[model samples]
Target: MKESEFIKKNSVFWRKLKKELKRSGPLTCRDTFPDDYEKVCYQIGLSRQRGYNLELIDSLDSLALRMRQELYRKPSLSLHNLLYQFLVETPRVIRGNFSYVLAALFLFTLPAIATYFILLKQPHLAFVLIDPANIEHIEDMYRDNAPHLGAPADVDSRVMMFGYYIKNNIGIDFSCFAGGILVGIGSIFFLVFNGFFLGTIFGHLENQGLGYNLSLFVVSHAPMELMALVFSGAAGMKMGFSFLIPGPYTRLHSLRKSSLIGVKFLILAAIMTFVAAAIEAYWSSLPHLDMQSRVIFSLSNVLLIGAYVGLLGWKRGPI
Candidate 1:
């Protein structure tokens, strides 16, 4: 019960506990954690009761706290865990915020539909929405005899395109998400602008009799690309809405709370964009698949994506 006697009795155990805590790599303390932790808890109580030196008591308290943290800490990341997070947690988050997704879809689609109709009626409007040079370039690319329409021909070219797509897509996603801090006007603007511009291009292509070629080139990746962009816009809007209507929390707290959810959506959007780019660079460009085959493949992609997003994480509960 004397302070000196207590210290002598517990010093060896404390040293061993510290050594175990400092071990590199995976914690090998799991098997003995319960006993060691309980023992430390008891030691701390005894040290206090015996009027031990303040330094000794403080060290015991710190050790006990560290043990508790180590015992309850989250598991380290692994391949399987990462896959589960992507395949499971990501979709769950999306589904939970399906309203935002729907809003994003509408925001992007309505403008596109309107612009498509307008451009279809008057093809010259395409020049207004898109640069004249870019319009010409698109027209040339889809021309019947054009050589490099779908994907680049060489391996290096494909890789370069892939990298380009990743950068471009990520940039767009970041802009859309960051725009939320502006109270969502930026997100809305970018989404509508992009949708209208794209629709104009499609309408112009159709008027020029290149619709089939353009569809063939874009159909394979359109679902993924379009959905990803929508999700990005949705995330931004969600954050913006949080700011506008923070409920009980202060504006700053609401923004922070919404950001947690928004970041997940952004991450999912990036993944989808990466996937779209891969397909665009490789599968979408296969030269051999006719227009019908390409359309079928594209439809299949839509169905697959729908199924994955709708059902992959169902009934699994939260991550």
Candidate 2:
């Protein structure tokens, strides 16, 4: 094969090597280029001597002898570098754990618990806990009874109900996830208390025949709200688990490593919570659905939550 034709076929490889040679003097041909060296030289058809002569012809005489030595260059993968350095590295820290999951459940149950005892034994406390003035603007709408337009009368009520559900439910979800930092117990307490409250509230609503209304309001936003909160709690629980099971690392190291698993979820949950709020605010309030429809919608929301958790509910790899 002609020198020029050989050069054309291996132009890219040769150009790169030539540039490296210019920056760092050429290698000697006698010292076998690491095992891979011959591949580069043979491909170019410029035997080490021919290359050395060519370098000399190009006015780089001093590099000729050095160029005779075959050189082996390390190859790199930019795709791998980019992915490993950023995306893959991030998820390593943000994982899920049993503790976080439990905590989230506990926190979500708080409302149910409060709704229980207070609904019967201490009815006043239920009123207080569910509509605590301590919570910002907890009684704002009830107190104001502000008029709403552009929707049916029931629509506004449904919307308000959905909003209330999201606000109340999302708060507990956040608590469950956040509480995981307390080594799972925090999350546990959060879940138990919240779940209890929710159960009790529904119980009370059921007795009053308003359960259907509540169910309808809940369906539209609950999917997003519940998932977001669960994710947050899962993150915290993962952190707690890290600390508890340090494995090869020190307690602090393990905790730091594990804590990273839930970060993306935490961020996503916060944003979803807000979207849920908007849905409650604008769409869910228009009470267009009847009782059966409401029940179906609520079930759909529950199903959606189940599916999402199933998809991203566990840790599959080492942190």
- The model with the greatest TM-score is 1
lDDT (C-alpha, whole model) for all candidates: 0.85, 0.57
Tell me how far candidate 2 lies from the true structure as C-alpha RMSD in angstroms. Answer: 12.2
List residue ranges in candidate 1 displaced over 4 A.
Answer: 1-9, 34-69, 78-89, 121-125, 150-152, 207-209, 248-260, 316-319
lDDT of 1 at 299: 86
Model 2 misplaced stretches (Cα beyond 4 Å): 1-103, 110-176, 196-200, 203-209, 309-319
Residues 179-211, candidate 1: write the lDDT tens digits.
877888888888988888888888999999999
